[model samples]
Target: MTIKEKINKFISEKKITHAEIGRGLNTSQQNVSRILGESGKVSLDFVVWLACEYPEIDLEKLIRDSDHVSIVRESPATYQKPRLKEKALEEIGAVLDKYM
Candidate 1:
């Protein structure tokens, strides 16, 4: 099914209102309506936020339906301090190398 269709189905099945989703996303109800409406565009950041907020929703399925590759490296809940530090170091090193 198409992304819009899937989202509509999810809305119906979950009995969730646009306002509820808006509240979760810290957006307006109108924005949520627009997001789920025809010609609505989904951003990777929005999808990631949704996936993080609602873990019951299958992110892989959402990504597939949206015709996008799943780029989520790992769930935020599973990110360890060491991993974060390592990533920070890598990013810092990359930036330094770019200048040097």
Candidate 2:
């Protein structure tokens, strides 16, 4: 199934309204309706936000149009902090320190 089809199926199965989705994403109900509507183009940023908000939905597999969409949660121990993010945080801290 296509991503839109999968998303539509998910919405139907979950009995979730567009307003609820909009609330979760901090967007308008109209915007959600547009996104879910036929011929509506789904953006990468929208997909990322949707995935982050609704962890239950396996968007990656849906994007690939995989038949089996499963949620695989990695352990915190298995998660590694990115050095770039660390450096950015350090830089922000330095800036704040300088200002304060």
Candidate 3:
């Protein structure tokens, strides 16, 4: 599944609301709705943030996208420090392993 589809499915299965996601992302519910809707662009930072926020979700798989079709939009130089991003991802994986 695509990253958006995986996220939408997770949200649906978990009963998470757009309002809750908006609150977490410090964005508007409408914006969250748009982000999850068709034609909405899902940013790379958003994916990392979502994975960190919801560690139970299999982010590695979502990101890897075995079929290689989903293209996560990147915020220009968002993660200036690649190591920092790596660390966060490692932590997310550790958390997922521990919990799931």
Candidate 4:
């Protein structure tokens, strides 16, 4: 399944509403609705933010489409800090604080 489909499925399976996700992500309900809308294209940064916010969700599964093979990296982990826009940084930090 595509990332968008996965998000929709996750929402349904968890019985989560857009307002709830918006509260967690520190965004408006309308923004969350827009993000999950039929034509919405989830960005990598947004996926990362979602993972950080809802750690219970399998991020790898959410990110990987069914048609693609999952690659396992044997190399040591490297921390490349994400460069998010100001608004995104604020929202991510707020969401993280709530969970952490």
Candidate 5:
């Protein structure tokens, strides 16, 4: 299913009017109507906002749109913090030292 189609289906299931969804997303009701009806496109940012807003919504289904998925990753690099704060440093160090 396309992304728009998925959203439309969910909207149907939720029995929510476009106005309500738009209100939740801080957009106009007519714009929401256009988005649902394929008269306008829903931006990736909007999709992200929707996902963040409705955490319980099935993302796999909700994000399935005709438009290609837009994955916005913050960063790929790893960051490290002292495990002492997590109180697992000793346990972690023991495992790592064993492997080494």
Candidate 6:
């Protein structure tokens, strides 16, 4: 599933309303709806946070979609940093484990 699809699915599964997620993430409810339905664009970290929070969610697919949205589920965490090397980051993610 794409990132958007994963987010939508997760939101539905979690029974989280758009307004509720927006409130939790400090975003707009309309924006949240637009994002999941492919009516907007968001940053990469937001999508990454979604993947990290909802490990079962498929973010790769969502980000690759034509809509280009990176936002996912309504987890309270945030993406703090990005590394240059994929291997290094992968190792870090593995070591950190929680955000992987």
Candidates' lDDT values, in order? Answer: 0.59, 0.60, 0.68, 0.60, 0.55, 0.54
- Candidate 2 has its poorest 10 consecutive residues by lDDT at 71-80
6-52, model 1: which lDDT tens digit per residue?
66676777777989888878999999888888888765445555545
State residue 92's C-alpha deviation in candidate 2, in Å.
27
By summed lDDT, which 10 consecutive residues of candidate 5 come out lowest?
Answer: 77-86
What digit string (tens of lDDT, one per residue) describes model 6 on residues 24-84? 5688998778777776655455555455445544333354444534344245434333422
Q: Is candidate 4 or candidate 6 better by lDDT?
A: 4
Estimate the TM-score of every prediction.
Answer: 0.58, 0.59, 0.65, 0.57, 0.55, 0.47
For model 4, residues 63-84, the per-residue Cα lDDT tens digits are 4444533222234323334533
Winner on TM-score between 5 and 6 is 5
Best-fitting candidate, scored by lDDT:
3
Clashes of 6: 4
- List, residue by residue over 1-100, the lDDT tens digit for candidate 5: 6767666766676677878777888889988887767577877556655555444444433443334333222343132333222223333344446554
Distance from true location, Cα of 91 in model 4, Å: 20
lDDT per residue, candidate 3, 1-100, as tens digits?
A: 7778877877887788999988888999999999999989888677777765654445555655466332332332233354555755675576567656
Per-residue lDDT of 24 in model 3:
80
Off by over 4 Å in 2: 68-100
Q: Give lDDT for model 5.
A: 0.55
What candidate 6 gets wrong by more than 4 Å, as runs, is 51-100
Candidate 1 stretches with Cα past 4 Å from truth are 65-100
Model 5 residue 8 CA deviation (Å) reads 0.5
RMSD of candidate 1 to true structure, Å: 8.7
Model 4 residue 81 lDDT score: 41
